[model samples]
Target: MRKNSIKNTRINGEVQKELSTIIRNEIKDPRIHPMTSVMAVEVAPDLKTCRAYISVLGEKEAKEATIKGLNSAEGYIRRQLARNLNLRNTPEIRFILDESIEYGVNMSKLIDDVTKKDSNSHRQDEEQDEN
Candidate 1:
């Protein structure tokens, strides 16, 4: 199947959803942070392997620990995924840390700060004009 074919897209969505649910509800590892989120999942066309992008809202140690925890629990997660989805091949799950969400948030804050400074300067300029 083509990488972006309709069927491939559907499989990616389904796998992403099921993986999210399994990680959030089934896994009980303490190393996996409570604020962990599965940001995205990409299943290869062959259905033999998958990449799960994860985001953890915590420090570096917590994020590392969460990945470690998930790696160790891969077998159980795969079993749960196979049971949940009736696919020809249950893809091997590989966890990857995604920082896009956090990056976007940081960029937004920077933009807001710049805009606030610009507006304040504009107000000062207006006052100086009036004076």
Candidate 2:
């Protein structure tokens, strides 16, 4: 099967959904923050390995701790995935920190600030013209 085949995509989506549920409801590790979320999942064509991208809305330390907690619970998570998905090979899971959401929010804030400044300048120019 090709790496980007529909089968792989379906597997990836299923894994992501199951992982989100497992992490949110099953895992009770204290190190994981309440705001942690599974952002995306990518599974290899062979289904031997899977990468889960996680996003945590918290400080850097919290994010690091969450990743550590998830890594420590990797075995349990894989087992749960196997039980839930009934796959022949429960892919070895790897947790990766995803910062794209945070980056996007920051970029939006910056754009808003620039837009506000430009509008204020335009208003001031209009006022001067009226004088």
- Per-model tally of clashing residue pairs: 0, 0
**lDDT for each residue of candidate 2 in 1-131, tens digit (9 for 90 to 100):** 68889988899999999999999999999999999999999998888999999999999999999999999999999999999997879999999999999999999999999999999999999999999
lDDT of 1 by residue, 1-131 (tens): 98899999999999889988988998999999999988888899999999999999989999999999999999999999999999999999999999999999999999999999999999999999999
Compute the lDDT of residue 95 as modeled in candidate 1: 97
Cα error of candidate 1 at position 104, Å: 0.3
Candidate 1 regions with alpha-carbon error over 4 angstroms: none
Q: For model 1, state the Cα shift of residue 5 in Å.
A: 1.1
Ten-residue stretch with the least lDDT total in model 2: 1-10
